[model samples]
Target: MANGKSLMTGLLVGGVIGGLATILTAPSSGRDLRTQLKQNKQKLESILIQLKDDSISLKESVVKTAQESAVVLKDVTADLQKSIQTWQEEIEPHKAELQKEISQIEEKIKELEQTLNK
Candidate 1:
C-alpha cells in the first residue's frame, strides 16, 4: 500500500518537474509556451485518470484475494478439529482396555500377597 502511494507521488511530482523544466528551457514565444503548457496539462490529467483506475482495480483484487483466503482458512481449521475428534474417539476403547488390564494385574498382586501371608 505504501509502495503504491509512493509510486503515485513519484509520478505526479516527476510530471510536474519535467513540465516546468521543459517550459523554462524552451525558447518559444509566449503564445507557443502557453499552448505547450495546455497540452502538457491535458496529458498529465489523462495519466492521473489512468492511474486512478488502475489503483481501484488493484484494491478490488486485494479484497477478493483476502476474502478467499479467509474462507480457505476457516475450512482448514474445521477439518483439523474434526480429525482431532475422530482420533480421540478411536483411542477411547484402547484406553479403556488398558485401564481394565491394569485393574486385573493389581487384583492378582493382592491375591498373591494374601497367599504369601497364609
Candidate 2:
C-alpha cells in the first residue's frame, strides 16, 4: 500500500512537472495560459471532491462492519457464560452425592476396625 501510494505521488509530481514545462514552452500569450491553468484547477478540485465522497463511504462501511461484529461477539460471550453456569449446576449435585458415599465408606471402615479390636 505504501509502495502504491509512493508510486502515485511520483506520477502526480512528474505529470505536474511535465505540464509546467509544456506551459512555459508554449507559444500562447500569458492570458491564454492563465485561462488553461484556471480550467485545470477546477478539474482538480472536482476530482478532490469525488475522492472525499468515496473516502467517507468507505469509512462508513468499515464502521458498520465493526458494529455488527461487536454485536455478534457480545451474543457469543453471553451464550458461553450461560453454558458454563449450566454445567456447574449440573455437576454440583453429583459432587455432593460422591462426598456422602465417601463418608459412609469411612464409617464402615471405622466400625470394622472397632470390632476387630474387641
Candidate 2: minimum summed lDDT over ten consecutive residues — where?
1-10
- lDDT for residue 76 in candidate 2, whole number 0-100: 100
- Candidate 1 regions off by >4 Å? 93-118
Residue clash pairs of candidate 2: none
TM-score of each: 0.70, 0.51
Candidate 1: C-alpha RMSD to true structure equals 4.1
TM-score of 1: 0.70
Per-residue accuracy of model 2 over 5-70 as CA lDDT, tens digit each: 676578668757977997989899899999988887787677667766876897799999999999
TM-score of 2: 0.51
- The CA lDDT of each predicted structure is 0.95, 0.86
Whole-model alpha-carbon lDDT for candidate 1? 0.95
